[model samples]
Target: MDRLIEAIEDKQNPSVVGLDPTPALVPVQVMDAYHIEADEYVEDDDDNLAATGAAAAYFEYNRAIIDAVADIVPAVKPQIAMYEALGPAGVDCYTMTCQYAREQGLYVIGDVKRGDIGSTAAAYAKHLSGFDGADVWHEDAITINPYLGSDGIEPFTAAAGETDRDLFILVRTSNPSSAQIQELELADGARVYEHVADLVEQWGADTIGRFGYARTGAVVGATHPEEGAALRARMPHTFFLVPGYGAQGGTAQSVAGMFDRDGSGAIVNSSRGIIGAWRDDPRYSETLEAQTALDLVAANARAAAEDMRDQLRVALA
Candidate 1:
């Protein structure tokens, strides 16, 4: 658990790459390299492409992104929906991506957002907490939905404690629809999410690492800057996994409040904005050469990431 905190502290910048693979957005070279028709593959459930080229494309795209940003960001988060849509083949790629990310010395956050009953939840925890077996297990932290309360969270909490892994509970999510529920005020005057935050903070207390931050964390969106800041202040020792940056339109300045005084308490995540930027951003693509296409696209993406980090520094300073 201390290793998790130390890894975050060492990076200084709390930016995380959200890997949500959309086959249409992958570079042609990557597509050609593996003879993968990702767009067609994702659409056809019974297509043989699922087991053949689709799985290969999944690993290739992720490997490319990891190579590009591994040096810059603290972690990579694979949105489970993208991988799970492919079924077991996608799960194999997810497993490969996790292993590759670990080898690159970056943390992996399984953005599965799973919430279930106690017995079933424990099964998920076992598979995801890297306790089932090293091959198919996820060694890093995962996101959990607390809508079911302690019954859903208890199994995850237990697994995290045993494995020294971490869980980032969804307190105030970034999606627009979240306001309908999370913002509802209780008779006690606390918003529903506020109470969730308090509970998450309490759950993480025993999991605190030596660096003064806990393995228990929260996924607060960068879209709600003020709320994110207020939550940061409320849970000073908790790690924050922030989404909604880049493609979701969250500016670095808007999310700057997530950082502590030293600028190391939270991580901002960007998925389509970083990986799929080449589709619209010509500064990256518009290349004819295969190698050049990969390099230019990767370069532009890295530059955008660096610019975001610089803005965060300015805002924090």
Candidate 2:
């Protein structure tokens, strides 16, 4: 787990590329190359053949993105909905994607965000912890929803203890609707999320890695920069996963406060803004394969990440 944390820290740019592949959103030429049919794509009620095709398409897209940006970024977060909707074949692709990412020296954070109780949560831990099976395991880390509070989180914590893995508790999400519940003022005047943040810090305290940061982390949305900064201050030793940076309209400057003076303790995630940029990019208009659309998007991502990192460096200086 320490090695996982250290890998991101060493990169200086703590940007995690989200591999969110939407069949309709991918470039037309790319889709045409695969000859992917709309009927074969993921639907609310996809049969096995449709599901298998969708999963295969997702696997190919993820592989291409990973090959392009793995060296530049710290980690890749594969959204579970996109994969799970495709069913078992999708699960197989998910497992392969994790394996491929590890081979490329990038951490795989399964964006499962699973929340349950007792045995079910433990089963999810086994499916995700990377220690259960040598082939299908994703060892880096998995996202956990803390809506059920300590009871929901305890099982993940216990699983981390067994596998030497880690968990990122969703304290503050980037979604706009999140404020309705997360910002509810508690009896003690602290917001509901603040209480969640406090618990995250405490749970992470016992799991501090070799570095000053702890393995337990909180998912603080970049949309709420001030609140994100407040959480950072409260849990100085905890790691942060800052989403909503790119497509969600969060600027690089807005997310600067989430990191330490050394540009550590946080990783900013962007999905549609990077991978989907090619569709709207003027430079990508000239030639799809000949030009570097993916490369350009990846470069821009690296630049955005580094720019945010440099802002912290300048602030500290």
Candidate 3:
């Protein structure tokens, strides 16, 4: 977490691009370049050409975007669900993407959101912690589901402690239906997410890093500014991973309070808005060849990230 914050401070940018790619979002050239052919992938359960092609395409696309934006942004978040849906081929792509990003000097946060209990929790923590054999998907930080409470989160904390990694426990997710659980009130009148926020502070206390913030952080949706501001005051020591910007309708103005008075302690994520920028960029030329088309996408991603960084600065001011 300290390292992540340092990266943010060094770049003076609190934005992270989410490398969550869908088939439609990736370029056709990428799919054609690395896709596992239909005949080569044998499992009917996971062997669809589209799925495999999408994974390969995403990896190629991720590499291009990372190449373009790595210098300005501090990190890249790869939502695991996007890769897991495609099966082993997708998993391989995810691993490859992480490795490539790390090589490019960018932090990788695996949005696994795994939750369980006891040994099960331990196993989930172990896997998500990047202990799987021949690991290539090692992450500098990860997101975990906090619904199962302390039992499910303790293993991850313990794992992080040993690995010197960081964890962002989901407190208030971005989806509209998240209120069903996160907004519930206890007998004490505290909202469910508030209680979770308090626990997150406690969990992160022992791991307080050099920046006066903890390695354990919270995922607070940027869509709810009042609650986000409230959480900001409540968990001063816990960093935040703010999502729901751009495509999710979260504005920089709404997320401003997620940061501290100095404009530190949080990172706003923009996925499709950054990766899919080529769709709207006037610089894109349909007449270009495959490699040039990929370069245009890369340039578009870089431009979008720079634009978001400036917007965030304005909102913070």
Candidate 4:
């Protein structure tokens, strides 16, 4: 966690761009270039051609975003689903994105949310976190699901210890319907999330990092300010991957409590709000929504990152 905290302090920013690119958000020019670049790999297979082209598009868009904001932000969390949406080639895009981000000296939090038991869990624990092998998909950290209980949680923590990496356990998510499951009351008088938070604390107890926080952090959504604050008190030693900002309606004021008073324990994430800003934000209104100039596309992303940094700075101040 010292590595992660160092990046945060170096950039003076606590948020990471979620490189969750979609065709709708990507400029058509980039897509056309992708298809052309895929020509070498296409040969005779139509399906492979389409997948290759789409994968190329995603990779290029993600690379541009990375190049744009790498210096200002500590990391990039490429929501695996975005790449997984494209099938095998999509997975290739996911791994390739990881490789490129690391090359740029940025950290990565794989938004996989994987959870299982026994050997299956152990396998995921080995492959997902830590960049020990040549496989580029190895991430700096990954989000994990705690539904299967401690058995599911221990494997990832073990994996985290093997490297200076981490795992963000899903305690309370940001979605509107998260409560239906995460907020259920247990017989012990603790809410479901509170129970999960306690599990996160227990799991990370042996692995506190150089930053005085644990490698096993919690995914407590900033959307629930009160709940986020309470979880902050409960898991003082855990870091937080606070999502639901920007596109999901989370604000600086809402997520302020997700951090320690020192403002070093959380990393906020803004996905569509930053990646799709060429379309969604008024500041970039004049830019063409389709086939944007690559430089302008990246420039806008950098601006959005700076703006997010400022917002957090104001809140923390």
Error of 4 at 295 (Å): 1.8
Question: For residues 48-152, could you state the per-residue lDDT of candidate 4 as single tens digits?
Answer: 776789889888788888999998999999999988888898998898898899999999999999999857788888755434564546589999999998988
Tens-digit lDDT track of model 1 for 1-317: 46655675576666777888866766766656555455444565656564546567768778877888887777889987887877787788888898899899988889999999888898888755555355365558899999888888888888888777788999998889999999999999999999999998988787778767787789999889999999999997788989999777788888888888877778788887777766666555444655566665577667766776677767778
TM-score of each: 0.89, 0.85, 0.93, 0.94
Please provide, for model 3 over 156-201, each residue's C-alpha lDDT reduced to its tens digit, 9 standing for 90 to 100.
8888887778899999999999999889989999999999999999
What ranges in model 1 sit over 4 Å off? Answer: 36-46, 131-135, 280-292
TM-score of 2: 0.85
Q: Model 4 reaches what TM-score against the true structure?
A: 0.94
Off by over 4 Å in 2: 32-47, 130-132, 283-317
Best by TM-score: 4
Query: Which pairs of residues have clashing backbones in candidate 2?
Result: none
Question: Lowest summed lDDT over 10 consecutive residues: which window, candidate 4?
Answer: 282-291
Clashes of each: 1, 0, 0, 1
RMSD over all Cα atoms, model 4: 2.3
Candidate order by decreasing TM-score: 4, 3, 1, 2
Reference-based lDDT, each prediction = 0.79, 0.75, 0.86, 0.86
